[model samples]
Target: MSDGPRLPGVEREADEDRIVCHVDADCFYASCERLREPELREEPLVVGMGYEEGETIGAVATASYEAREFGVESAQAISTALERLPRRAAFEDGTLDDPDLEREDTGYYRPVDMDYYESVAADVREILHDCAGVVREVSIDEAYLDVTERTAWEVADGFARHIRDRIRREVGVTVSVGVAPTMSAAKIASDFDKPDGLTVVEPGNVREFLAPLEVDLLHGVGPVTARELREMGLETAGDVAAADPEPLVERFGERGRELYDRARGEDDRRIEPKGDPKSFSRESAFAEPVEEPDPKYDLIETLADAVADRARREGALYRTIGVKAVTPPYDVNTRERSLPGPIDDRDLVDRIARDLFAEFEREPVRKLGVRVANLEFATADQTSLAGWESAVESDPEPDSESEPETGSERESGAEPGLESDPDPDPDSEPDPASGDRLVGQTSLADFS
Candidate 1:
């Protein structure tokens, strides 16, 4: 009944269970920069914030292990990083800083040019598409592959190695991959060694692999959630696994059940593909916020093209257009417009996307996105707008102007037309620097 492979290194099973692999590009942003310039391969590199080297307001986008040696880390504010490493001046040269640009107090900081990174991410995704049977992209740097048909874990490691080498040679980035019986388990494994680590978690070893890790390592647990779990004396995945579900439910509500399932390595979530992503969005956070229209428009054009490509690949069409703009510190803004009906017109998507983007006008934006909301599978019966079923019962307009939904929610976790609910914000920008998880409220099958 199970599609899991029968091979060594994979968990022994008596029943149906799926073999899933989670592939995550290591130090995605920093790695992408290294690809652009081969010389920085082993150098101490940190990508985050704006050009200023000493400012901590902006978080670390990614730090090469070399940088990590000096305590530089992703998500840690850049200002705080200066205390650990020397500072360096920025290069607006539209090129990697000259090796000579180094300074004592100002360590090296690379401004995030998502346009370059997005292109590299696409190449990596292409490698995954070639290797996977059922591929589901989780982020620009992360994805889930169902390799059940083509390979087994005994050989999965080799597959991962080949993919890794290809990504490095062809895509110019290294990735860490984890293979396991379930998606959650594989995700945890992928993060184990990091920066080109290859970890495989067998089904039988799932519990063993997860037991010693802190509760926060579980997919859904965050700082706040972990803190609350700790108050109940639950520190490790094992602790949470052993706790009574009712009490957890009483304390954290729905999240409690989710925690319990993850603790027990019971994730039933599938590698559901978004038949075609209605919208593809990429946001670049800068230390110094940007309000310039020309520059922002350029970036929007780049992102719009990528989204169009994804829609084309998935055979999906869109009619609604939207965008999200985040102003420094923590202000999230969003806007959306609906089309006449489902249409696969990329130029139209681009034109409408840009039109919607005009609203941002000159607003300072630390992050920005482009979205096509009224989605319909391109392969579906082509019909006029009046004949199609709506994704939601209400109007197709985005329920509210908020940050894009989280990646998870965008695929199938968020409830349509119910943006204010507890569902995860799927469209929100994913922090490659930080493994931030956002799940929308919807069924996986809906998107697939």
Candidate 2:
């Protein structure tokens, strides 16, 4: 029920500069699931594996902030989580699954349908491009937009609000937007609110706004780093800014200086559209050491689903599929197999992933990972454009019966009437914003 901040006019600037904004979909997987089935919106929804009441085989993928309020969090053991939140029965009874309802914890599992998640993520990406003048998608649920060319902050906030509404209306999800003078500031601002919230931080006010924030909130300050910073009496970002640099450097080396700059609201990273990556991986760690292979195979299938879904979502085809197993702290193993041609097939991915998992049959794996590597981000037509020309110019008349069908003929065809336009880059700039209203964007492509 939180309404975001209003747009403000620019006051002044030291020099001409571009404006950036970071937009992050809140509890993305949970939100996506909510969009898929609206009934779960008001419930304490959790998305993860090993929902078979008290099972330790699965980890949580995402939990709504509402769920988080009850101590549910990502990567936590599902068995322990049910003890904190009320257990809701699964859909087998045609009733909503709330973890707090049942005590015995029978059938507490919620399966991850990566195919459905990918479809929704793709739709979200489309919505992002529409709102951006320059969009740099950092992950499935987050993106940075440079809106300097077409609009400024005063007007762009309205645009962001409209996007938020449109996504809820058409896509059935909520997103948080953070606006600041720099990418670092903006990234932090977006997290200020939960689902469906927006916050704006102007350039001149960056230091004042960041001063009271926890040192852990700084971009690169992890829990370990935050603990160290606390030991140095640097509890808040402002403390880090005020601390002597010499002492910090003595303790943490070059990273210490980097932390100092970040704490002072100084990060200068740009949003660049890097296309599909060369590999995709999904991994899961058990709450306890897992020695059995059955649970390991189950996790591998889940990872396979994630890998295939990623390839299709990014319009990427992969030549190699691989698996990684971490037995504990020291032992790590990986294996891969190349394919005859680049493919986006889920069955084929599972086949290769499972084949690689066979190597670790005797190993006690605590964590299992599946990856699709050597990715190429071109449509079949784009990759084979030259081949098309060669067929047209063949000396003997090409087989008229062998003509390729139009894209629309495919079962999962592009939307109607929009087929003529090429798919815009997922990460494009936003509509222009005035200099003062511009916030920041995140450059990291991998999802945290």
TM-score of each: 0.58, 0.58
Per-residue CA lDDT of model 2 for 1-448, tens digit only, reads 0021323553434354556777777776676566545566666777766666455565566667667777776655565566566455643464545644553333222555544454345556555554564567655566777665545656656766777777666555677888776777877787777558878777677888889999877765656777888999999999999989888999888888877887887877777666554466666667666877788888889879976775676678776777767554324456776655566778767766786678576677766777777778764642322333343234423211211111100001111111111222222222233111111212233321
**TM value for model 2:** 0.58
Angstrom error at residue 199, model 2:
0.7
Q: lDDT of candidate 1 vs native?
A: 0.63
Model 1, range 143-250, lDDT digits (tens) per residue? 788777656656767877777787777555778888888887887888887768888887678888898999877765666777888999999999988889999999
For each candidate, the alpha-carbon lDDT, in order, equals: 0.63, 0.61
CA deviation > 4 Å runs, candidate 1: 1-15, 53-57, 90-106, 277-448
Best by lDDT: 1
